[model samples]
Target: MTHKRKIFAGMSAIAAASLVLTGCGGGGGGDVDADGNVVIELAQWWEPELPDGALRGLMDQFEEQNPGIKVELLSGPYASTREQLVTGAASGTMPDVVGLDGAWVNDFAKQGAIADLSALMTEHDYDDSQLASQVEVDGSTYMVPAVNFVYPLYTNDALLADAGVDAPPSNRTEFADAARAITEAGDAAGTAMPLSLETPSGVQNQVMSWLWASGGSMLKDGKPDLTNDGVTETIEYFDDLYQDGVFAPGAFTMKEQDMVEEFTNGRVGMMVDSLAHLTMIRESNPDLKFSISALPAEDGYDGKRGIPYASWGLGVSESSDHKEEAWKLFEFLMSEDANAELASMAKAFPGNVASVPDFVEDDELMSQAFDIYQAGYPANEFTGLPVAE
Candidate 1:
């Protein structure tokens, strides 16, 4: 299961970066015990690692290295993570540290469920730019990204070659041509788009990306604006692609996961999904060569680099007496050694730039994912509702 990473010709290098503040709120949850040892509970939705494993190895190392702090994990699936944290926070029973979704950061900050991490980051000299999903609200930093995922366009190089598509497309017009070429060659569907209008997430994969890349947004001033000019233009472009037979017939009904399978099975030329799919594809379609890049945009439209920001991150409960201790554990887990463990175990990339592991740095495909994620985009967490526009 080897992947040969691709580099977009004539594309400049990608830059990565991330935020904000208020409240002496780090004093409520689990705290230090009578033995002068701090006991911090970290309840996260990230699998600690993949199935059949956990992040215990890294924690074990951390505990051995830092004798005074004891880190406890409250494990569960991501589906119920937010509910658990929300209920716990409301009851003042939340863990010392908790896992957060990108969309939850702002609300939690407003609720004062999480502590400000600026001071802690500064004190530890943590280079924050590495965080793919660092959560900031109204200019204050609330959380540091951990298990982050980015939805990038993955193309099957072999399919593209077989279709005689010599180069990747940088704009929609060019992309359509490439897609047409692939379809005409009969190697596979040019692309598999996720467009099940059944859910907001479906819309995101098939459309929101284009809006953001074209300088439009799903949320403006806290309200949903579905009729923005950029959105309309994107829709028109999508319509053109559809009419041209650039997308598979099932694309309009397929969920994101289904499209992922289409790409891996060689039934589709490209897939719009998480970089994690690479590992999955490696297992399911071992001989495939693929490359990933940000979704294509109009040639002059911000060069089509915009996309959404999403991740799982570490946050200290507002009332944790052991804020410093909690941060210590976080820093350790996000360190180079421990972060690498996360990649191998959880199929996650490092949230800290300094901790990028070899598996990423050594592989062009994986390395490119880090670059795409770091290249900031006009994003909306798209939580529940937008503020009044």
Candidate 2:
């Protein structure tokens, strides 16, 4: 059978297991009590392995605030979390609230598994602009953006200075020159871009950023435009960068963490990564002097500097019977203070635009990151492409 079919089969098994567990009164599907206390299961992928506890803590706080509601956090590995959610939706056993990546919103929305949060926002007087465009589709909100991270060039300032470079590159040409200088210094690998073919996430991330920087998008009016000059140019740039020995020997096999670790260990002078790396850098090396700046632009392209904003949002499952309570939980999470607190706890940037100013005031790297985010463009969404299954 096809890979998708196999995934579906595995998901079906998981759903069946969940049903059996629920029937035995060993899971989160128990009925509500007379005290108005409702047990709501929240399916999420932020397990201990992920290291982000803000979401969990937020849920705990919600439970405390609303004594009548109890939220059960269901954590799972990232590999099967999405599949489980899809299966839950299909089987009408989805959790009350779910933490999902913005990219997955389109797919779930298309499947009619997510509720229309626009009405809730309107009723609550919530400002939609606080959320990113990706979470808002066709004038109806489907999710509450929790945290956002912008992709930027991470530079080791001390290493650059040791190599006689005063600052990070501002444009593509300057970056190329600096990479050569660092490589010639003979201290370590000069510059590394994630050129790993094995890790499609890295490849896609880099390509999408370059594509945006080159004044091109993945889809123009909802159709793939592979023949677009911008797309071709970006791909060719990666091929050339690979052939030039700028990347590590097995960069094609390098994952995101691997690349970040290399830069953190001083094995690389510069690396491109998400802004969320700020806290990791601080924790990994307290003395490390690194700076985050916008990715360099193509030589002559005058378009906005592009930084991919990676984020997750909270959404109520349409299969849920407690959407009102779920919305209350969602509203609490999206509140300014709540978002700020979670962002600080998670060591991540906030999704609420208003919270950006607060984040900037406290974290310098986040300040620069906010600048990049404001100057960046949104991720491209195509209409005709089949959503990932």
Candidate 3:
């Protein structure tokens, strides 16, 4: 902090200063601006619906708080964010500050692209439990969460009533009963799970939640252990679900988006989905009675019930010359106000826990996520599993 501040000297006391703005118009750039401010290019896949200038507002506030630093946003759709990040690192054109998907954290670290944030975590007092587990590998940390995703179970109350399930299922045995009962009542499939290796990641998400809730894990000997008892039981149980028509036969080929479509169309009685759809649920089914809950666990499993977590994190590039400034921007972005603003629009878990209580739209999901932010394992059991595999 001491040495980095000397890198920029201002024009006296600044007579009504003007902030410089370079949007995501073209490529990335991390240079000294004409105004003597350090330009830090920030690349993220912030949704377009976030008040149009939510990120811009953050940048403006950061500039106002700390003079002589300008953050340029290189925003794009989520579909291309990962590709853009990978290509940028490969071509030596990466932004000074970039947002990455939770899954990319380990890969980026292996490629030597992102700086380790261990020291920063210590300096900033960031608890590992409060942060997403995906950003940390071995004994080092690579990224700090930008926004974390909160996944919750969505249950159709009408279907449950029709099936005579007065309360939500808390364990796998009851879960099966509920699924079968709902399906047998002629409403639709009992539950919708994305099981298709067509999108391998989606398969991991679908399976891992069930496994974790059953107190199983992916890494038995530092690799995916498909032979784990819980994993095997989950596979068998899901097979039963498919065979009994509790889950659609196409569950083996359905993607996450497909689940979303079917659930929204009132074809599924229960499903696990992101908090992002809080608004979409009301829009899709105005009369549907639904409730949210944590995923079910095994009847006799004594271990903790874990859920899937997806994170978007902020990290400085490994080769960047502005590590200190980059860390500053990272801190600013993760501040409570900034975190809440982004989370309010993103409809996901906020990076800062202080912002959790303010959320009310999907309060159960947000509150649950906040309480257990330091909890849960990955949705993917294995690493580097290609889609075709």
Which candidate leads in TM-score? 3
**Tens-place lDDT digits, model 1, residues 108-205:** 77777787787678877887766544556666678766655667778889888988877666677777888888899985889867777654476765
Global lDDT of model 1: 0.68
Query: RMSD in angstroms, all models?
Result: 11.0, 4.1, 9.7
Which parts of model 3 have CA positions greater than 4 angstroms off? 1-29, 47-49, 122-134, 301-303, 361-389
> How many steric overlaps are in each model, in order?
11, 2, 1
Query: Please, what is the whole-model Cα lDDT of each candidate in the order they appear?
Result: 0.68, 0.69, 0.69
User: lDDT tens digits, residues 1-389, model 2?
Assistant: 99999999877777655643453143323347677788777776665444467567777888888888987777776545676676666666667788787667777777778888887777878777766443655557776667765678888887788778889987777776777667767666766656556656675566667676555677655556787777777778767766766665467677788878888888788887877677787899888888888777788767776566566568887877777777777877777777777666655666666564355777777777777777775453421134622
Residue-level lDDT tens digits of model 3 in 127-201: 645443435566576776667675667788888888999977877788889999988898588998776765766
Better of 1 and 2 by lDDT: 2
Question: Rank by TM-score, descending?
Answer: 3, 2, 1
| Residue pairs with backbone overlap in model 3 | 129-374
Prediction 2 global C-alpha lDDT: 0.69
Candidate 1 residue 246 C-alpha distance from true site, Å: 2.4
